[model samples]
Target chain A: MTTIAPAVSGRRRTKSLGSLEMGRPGFAWAIPATLFFGLFAIVPLILVAVLSFTRWDGLSSPELVGFENWSALLDDPIMIKSLWLSLLLTVLGVVIQTPLSVLLGVWAAGHQRNRAILSAIYFIPLLLSATAVSVLWRALLDPNFGIPAQASWLFGNGNLFGKQATAIGVLAFVSTWQFTPFHTLIYQGAARAIPRVLYQAAEIDGASTVRQFWSITLPQLRNSMITSMILMVVGGLTTFDTVLILTQGGPGTDTMISAYYMYEKGFRNFEFGAASAIALVLVVVATLVSLVVVRASGYDKMRSTLEGM
Target chain B: MKTRFTRTVTGTAVLALGLSLSACGSSDSGGTGASPAGEESGQFHVLVYGDATNKVEKQIVDTFNKTSKVKAVLDTIPGADYQQKLQTIINTDQAPDVFFNWGGGSIAPFVRANLLLPLDDYIAKDPGLKSNFLPSVFNSASVNGKAYGVPMRGTQPVMLFNNKKVLADAGVTPPTTWDELIAAVQKLKAKGVTPIALGGGDQWPTLMWFEYAYDRIAGPELFQKALDGDKQAWAGEDSKKALTMLKQLIDTGAFGDKFDSVKFTDQGSPTLLANGKAGFELMGSWEYATIQDFNLKFAKNDLGYTNFPSIAGGKGDPNNVVGNTNNFYSVLKKTKTPKAVGEFLKLMYSDEFVKASLAIGNLPTTTNTEKFLDAADNPDYLKYQFNLVKQAPSFQLSWDQAYPPSGIEPIHRAVQQFFSGQIDADGFIQAMQALPAA
Candidate 1:
């Protein structure tokens, strides 16, 4: 009892000491970080925000015209369409990818051979650089002499990229194809950490594989599922490289998204000021969408748990 | 202590980035500089659009450097990124001494910004430089009655290139009239071949068909007026007729259904012509040399050339040419060595430059080009283009190049939409009228 008293008192002393130092007047440790953030993050953000109100050729002094760039957004049909498409891709990507990843992950966790072969196949896409994937798919989907064209009996006319409906659909399919495996790997990790005794006990009680998965496997994987959904929303909103190389927003601007539109404005048109405006607007939209995703999808629980840890 | 170290590291990185952005921004937004000319003693850099034709440019620059104490250094930017890179660097102190340009609208903005050196004084001292080239070709690079660019390289008149074996297989000769061209499309389509190879994937190649059609039906005056701010000209009866003909060709399946997927930049369209899968391709004269380099047998035994067909009773002369009349070399206002650069301009009209350019498949527009036609790689092909250029009553510059940079993409998009049946005649006219005029 005497030994325990000293240990408790020592821990209390350290706690009090930490609280005492928190009230120090100087910001010696914080000053460098604050200044660095002010210089890089704050300064660049303000520059972009200010430039959005101007009209400038990239090579000349910007001419200020307040709210003009913002006003132009209303008349710009392509910009509006791009935003809607980005949101659609975000929602659809999560809905499609989550189920596929969860099923594959549950199935692969059963045995060593199943895990090895399925993991190898699923991980192959993540290994490829975005550029190589885009070009390879372009050739494979070529309407003249490619795999789809040769097997036209299955893929009507092999001109899937020509029609607007099919092109956007195919774009979503390609995105899901490349990204579902990552989510699967996350779910599999979570599955491994689950106690084997829980499953064995459920099986002895005559619970089927599907019933055990529904009651035990799913409840255990809730945190990983939420994490993956948030990541997917962020990634889907910013899909630039794959789209740029594949269609180039073409067959007459059918597949253009916000990122590509921003590029076209800045690089192709040399209208840097307007492009900056588009970028800031995109950032704001993404933030709001992400907030809604987190609140609606139980991400607060995971974040709070992390904070507590 | 650990927190302090991390803060310092981040602070340094931020400071570095801020300094970098400030430095790059000044040059880009510099507008114009106060200083104009530089000393004319040392070597001057000349930037060219890098492509297959750069071989000829290198030889000419080498010959000039060998003779003059003030030497010229050559730099090439890959063809795709040339324009954007030039715009970025031209405002900086690192601006090229002289640069390749399409003249007219391509250099108009630079000229307006006063970034170009007007060559009028140089022309006054050297009469031969102005007089040696054809007036039409020389006038291509002129703005407001003052010459801004010297005729460098060669003329590039767009011509109807064909596969001789493909045409023979279909039992059709090269068409000389609009009706005959339509008939040949029908014959070629019935023979199970893609009648014409079009690189619609690259937007500029799609514009050539429109250039020839508009020039043949409405004449050069129509586009000249349209360019001069008569937007109503786009809605005129003659313009409607030309658009109708293009629609007819598309409907008859002259270009295959998959042309929108093929590209000239990647050699896809050329491959079709070379492999005898297509009967015809309307392309720049450079196609002859390109086909030769890629597939020697096709260039030797099967490549064919002819003028764009005349539209009967139309407003144009049958011999009117359309395409890049010639590419030019314009002087930068910030050149470190102006006098030496002017001396180098004289070499463009020199026999050595002409011969080297002709040894490749370039059709030099010099008045003395006639003397060296026999030295051309394919002399017969050279004679055909030479006669075509010499006899042209008017050479309509490709609309995209002739129009300002701002208008190029809109023009390309409208044409693509029309050809794909996305827009009608009135829709196209509205799009063209919406374009800002020079």
Candidate 2:
């Protein structure tokens, strides 16, 4: 009843202020951004959806093919395997990065001077473009000339890219190294925003540090976790530059994730229609995953974890 | 809180949009004139692959522009992105009047789409254009008996390159026959060196082995048949024999265990040879230039090359060669300045062109190229390639370039898998059979 009372008064206040032109900014302020988004994002997406139904190589005029591309994709063994690989890589990213970043983010959120210096050094990798990072790691892992040659006992021929397991492992490892800092920054900001009084109260209750974190810090980071996971999901689904520079979907298409497979199909094979189909599937999956995460986590309700604190 | 959530959703949407956006190439209008071949009023663009060799192309363009009223503009896309970018713009109004390509499957789609101007008329106007180049090389750009391109760059026939000092230390000589090659490999292996430095990671380097082996065992007709939609050609006895021979080479530890992780583009395999870790490498003629760029002393003195060893009873001619035939400049159908384009192409075989090409270590296919051979950066190597190309009965285009671009991935995958023992003879055959028809 108390929560509902403020909401009813807020609606009345906004309505009264609306007549005096003192409420929220009018929809006109959003027109430019809306137009830009519509032109760049919405229109292209609609066109791609239409293109998925046509059979067209780049040189020829597109012909209406109905559901031929979709049906062919459904039968494509590589497409199925690529989907599984995408899922596996995404799961690996979330599983490995979530705890790691959370801990690092919390630690970096401290007031220690040394922590600031170390975190700054840790963020250097995040500054490099994905292509640069991938190229650096590729050189470092070269079997005959790189670190592998100096430590043959540990590397054993350094066929990291020659086998499927190791190729995926490399992709996951490089991406984690490149992206963990970014998610850590998100958690760091969120951790700073967590009211310090909650900690004080927990301390007075004689709670241990780990207990305080489990009960207060973890619960308070629920919103940040959802935001970070959604980012990881989307980024993982579209992981292209690393895979291209590192493995190139090689070792007999073992690491052919969906995004790269789409590129190979569209650009290399000139099967634009099939590629568009794959692109649409990626979009739908990413959107649905994000939506489900938001819905399942009760994120849309915007309930405050500190509601009665 | 709502604003933050909205921003996150918007950000996710943007990321998803990027995937589909990249799937479709940019359709923005280019800065070039939109009018269809606006006569002599505007410049006719010439797009070539961007690389160190571009200086020769630039000089040629300047020489062309000196006399021509409809001036030529040289545009370049970086080497790696050239093919993809060309495809994206080839069908648009932004398409260049003349573009460089590997010919064969590279320009086949343009021909099928009627976007290419057949060069037969140009050849008829000036018979020198057709007769100037070697017929074996000239026919590479022809489609269905119609001439479509004029050879612009040097031929890149794959040859067996060796570390001469390493071979000498191992008491071996460059092999001339299949038996001798095997014997040499054994000696090199026994000498505690890898017999060959293969950049299997690059995939295309591995394809070279399959290309020469198939040509040796089955002749150029087999690949021609396979490319012409005869899938059974891959399943034939000749194809199996070629695959078996390649498997034998791999199993003999010819490429060593780490070949799959070494790449030629990154100086991996080349370093192996230069360091005497390996004895030989089968590579394109440009390998000389590539090695010269990195290890000049070794390239100048120790570099050795020979034709791929001949198989005794093979169907292929002993003198047959397989590699990139040469790059060609194909004119688009919409060019209004056909007269200017013809005059520009005439310069391709001019003495100046030949001299400049040889100066840069490129062996021009022009008949007059022989006269300029002595002035080349490396006269002996240039003369050897020129003589080899001149006497070769058939200059088989690489299998990847011989088929449409769609076939590249499958061909590379099949060869790489065969080398890595991931696939066998039957599996390799099936992969080849599945390639898109030429």
Candidate 3:
């Protein structure tokens, strides 16, 4: 005991000395990243906020219109509908993607050759660009000559794009298909980081495999779940390219979500002011949703699941 | 500690230097576009819609550069984003000296902004600039009786393009009157085929049906009056009659229910026609080239085109045509070398321009176009379009182009909604009446 005490004290003294010598990185260390973020994100956001208060048709000089665009947007039915649709699509994405990715991720965490091979194959859809994926699905879902024609029993008349429900379903399914692997990868990394000692203790207590998973694995994944959910919520709210290439806010604007509507107003209709207002609303909404999720999930507290252990 | 601090400082300085250098490079490049007239002396930029047609524009620019001391550099914005990018850059210092425009409402906004140069003086100096092209085509670019653009490309008149085999199989000949067209639609539909391949997803393709129906029933006067800010024209009985006829066509299932799922831009509707799933498609003359590019064998053998069927007792002349009259190049007022710009405009009527445009299956509206018709590929097709335009009493610009650019989305939405049965006749009329005047 005496010999061990002196050795432990000596190690602690060395650790203290090493830490004292190592200086913390200064503000200059963050300069490059801060500058990049300022130029690309913050500057453009400020400009968009300024433009939202003006009437710019992109041809003539922008005229300051004050609250005109904001008031008009408030009264616009399409604007309201678009907001609702954005929320619906976003919620659908989370509901469909969360459980799917979680299961796949936990399964993929196993270090089996088959699991590795299957996960690699599943990751391919995530690598393709949103444009390429939308086009590929559009061709696949075509009513006359695509997979729908071959599987008419499943898809009646295959008017998936001409109706609202099916159109939204396609958007949700396509997004889930394209993005699940990304979330799965996140969960897999977290799942692998889980302590094996907890599982061993649960097994000693006569816990079944399912019960052990429910008691330990899920609780351990709390932090990763919050991270993955926030990402999904933001991704769904800003879904644009898939909608543009697939639906084009069509079947009489039934599928017109906020992002595409903003594009239509800005690029197609040349109503820059109104579009900027819509953009700001999108940004605020995404931010608020993320904040609510972070707060409700207790993610902001930064409490570690392994704190007691 | 000092060494690490120095390294950090050096790294940041290097990063700062690199960033500033890149920023300087970008600014220098941007200055080139802005100072083309002064700093980039003896040269002007000619921006056009980027497409297969750009090859001709490039050749024309090369021809001009070979002779003139003032060189013309050709730039192209891909067709889809051309209008938006043009408007964004037009009033800025980066604006092209000469740029492509659709001539009617397309340029009206630029003209109103005083950004465009009036070409009356140039035309006065060179009578051939005014006289070389067809009067109907040239007058399209003239706003408020002042010429502002030179017709550069071929005219595009919407035609009823059909699959010859499909029509023959269905025993339906190309209709020349409204009633006969309805009968043909029924016949084709009865044969288990979509009578018309309307790319409703695109919305603009759906608008072609309305343009023809309105012109045939209410005459070109109604739309022109509407464009001239006469809202009453949309509420007129003739307007209602046109809507009724279009509604009947839609109710008859002429376009299959899934048309809203298809798009012309992606070769969806054209593929439907080529594959014999659809009997007809009313599309611009460019449809010919689009199909030819994809399925050369099909375009060569089965593609058949005819004039839009006329209404029997219509107020409009049976010979009235509606589509893009022609694409034109309008000069920016800020151009320093108006003389060099004039020399470039002169090439629009040059023999080389006409021949090159024709070889690519473009029907140039030049008076001398007929002279080289035999020399051009698809001479028969070129001659057909030439005569159709030549004989037409009024070549109404497309409703989308006749209305200011801001009105396009509303117009497309109204027509699509009407066709899809989301709105009735009254809804369509109110929508049309509410469009901002050109």
Candidate 4:
């Protein structure tokens, strides 16, 4: 009864504060932030949405074309193929980066040997801008004379960037190489925060290294895993600079993913109306995909883990 | 605690906005001119495409600034990004009063949008302006018979740049006919050298082969027909024959296995030409200067350039030329100092300008340029190009630059695909046929 009385009073005081928020100084202070976001973010988003239904060449005023751009974009073969490739890339990115980062993070965080040096080596890719990394990879993968191309004769002498399969594969590998370090750092931080005393308790219980990781480390790092997965999916959807520099969607549109296709259409083709439609479509898909990832990664399970801890 | 957290968040957000606001405040608009064109303003901006010739442009601007009341400020956007940046800023507040352009269909959109000033009025004030330049070159800068641009730089004509020593080693002279070219290709291949160094990765370099081959195949009329929206012209026999001839070269392995990965802009093809690896590279006349900068001895002793070979049965005159006519300076309609810009352009044809251009290996388009040919870095090369252009029955501008700006990418893509064998001749024809009618 004593505990229930304090909880009930606490709830009453929170309700009162919520009701009085309109008059509060904090709420007044938040107005500026709200207004800034509304002006910069919301307005542009609405403008793009409106433009998706118009025919605009950017030189003149936009003419409303009613659902023509959306229908045309949906009917485009290149857009369809590019959209599929985008999804495939997103799936590949999440599937590849998640497990590898978790493994690396756990190994570095849990192991006492050379952890600092090893993590730093893994972080070198994160230090390079996407443009630099892309140009480096392009030179390194030059079929006739690149060091990697010459050395990889053990595979075959087929041109890497010119062939369909190898082009996408090399680009994906380059993207993964650059971004995995980011996810690893997240997991490393999460692993470090899992309470060393719990690990000590498991050691006393005669738990093997792998067993301890499976039991405690993965569970404790659930939120970080979900956060990293959502981030990577969004990033993969928006991937541009690296692919643009490396390929420009060459070898006959084999590597043209959605964002790049949208760019080609808007900037190169002067079809901003069609590009706007593509941008809105990508946003919707990214949001839905993020929601799905959050659910599948067990957002409820993560909340329960937090509560139990 | 919650109140303290809100305070920190607010402080950080305010700090971030303040920082961004300050960052945006950089790039101050140069001194103001609130009056109309010809009204006295202290300064005006002139944007030029950045290249090896930037020093020459800078000298001209400096000369203009020394005595003129309205000083000219030079802004240069680097080579590859120039066209893209110009597009974004052309309709904006930051657009230069006078800007560089390729003229012709390249500036067709600007003219159509009423954003470019017709220079007829300025030309009337000084008849020497139009009369001082070559009729052919100057006419290219006109849109619908009204001058919108002034020829400001050298002419660019595509030529077959070669390594003389490599051809000599194979016992093959620079081919004057298509049959001889095939024979030379065969001889060169037997001697273990790539017959042609094609930069398929850059794509535009590959389009040179198409331009030359098409001109040699069906003459300039067919290309003009296609550009004028004759879909039937693309399906014509000459177009098909042109594609077939191009395919034959690709099938012969004249470019070798790795040509698709070699890029011209990154010195791949040029390196092949300067060394003994490739016998020939069909490139602009700029190839001489570019190679001379790196390997002077090879450029001076072994670099050989000649006209694109004539096809035996072709309807085109053997003297027809193809490439860029030249670069031009166009005035924006909103310029507040048209008279000043016109005055500045008068220097384009001045004897001082011709001497400065020749010193840099550029072949100026001024009719007075012929008299100054001996001043060029290589008199023989300059004379050869000038004669070729002057005697030419027709001069076909490279199709990519001749078409609307938005149309260049697809054309390059189509040419690259044709060279790579990714698409058949029908696909190539369809791509060309799809270009927006000029």
Interface RMSD of each: 7.3, 2.8, 9.9, 7.5
Clashing pairs in 3: none
Which residue runs does candidate 2 get wrong by more than 4 Å?
A1-25, A201-207, B1-11, B18-24, B27-43
lDDT of 3 by residue, B1-438 (tens): 544533343333333323332332243234222233334768898888888899899999999999999889887776476787777778776778999999999999899989999998898899999999888888888888899888888999989999999999999999999999999999999999999998888899999998888898978889988999999999999999999999999999999888877888878899999889999999998888889888998888999999999897789888888888999999999988889999999999989999999878788888998999988777777888899999988888888988888899889889888988889999999999989998
DockQ of 4: 0.20
What's the TM for model 3?
0.91
The alpha-carbon interface RMSD of model 1 comes to: 7.3
A137, model 1: CA deviation in Å? 2.2
- Residue A302 lDDT, candidate 4, scale 0-100: 51
10 residues in a row with least lDDT, candidate 2 chain A: A1-10
DockQ of all predictions against the true structure, Cα-based: 0.20, 0.44, 0.31, 0.20
Each model's C-alpha lDDT? 0.79, 0.86, 0.85, 0.80
Query: For every model shown, what is its TM-score relative to the native structure?
Result: 0.86, 0.93, 0.91, 0.87
Candidate 2 Cα deviation (angstroms), residue B85: 1.9
lDDT of model 2 at position B363? 89
For residue A60, model 1's alpha carbon misses the true position, in angstroms, by: 2.8
Q: Kindly list the per-residue Cα lDDT of model 2 for residues A213-305, writing each as its tens digit.
A: 899888889989987988898888878889999998988889999988988888888888998899888887777777777767777766656
TM-score leader? 2
A best-first ranking of the candidates according to their TM-score comes to: 2, 3, 4, 1
Candidate 2 chain B weakest lDDT stretch, 10 residues: B27-36
Single out the weakest 10-residue window by summed lDDT for candidate 4 chain A: A300-309
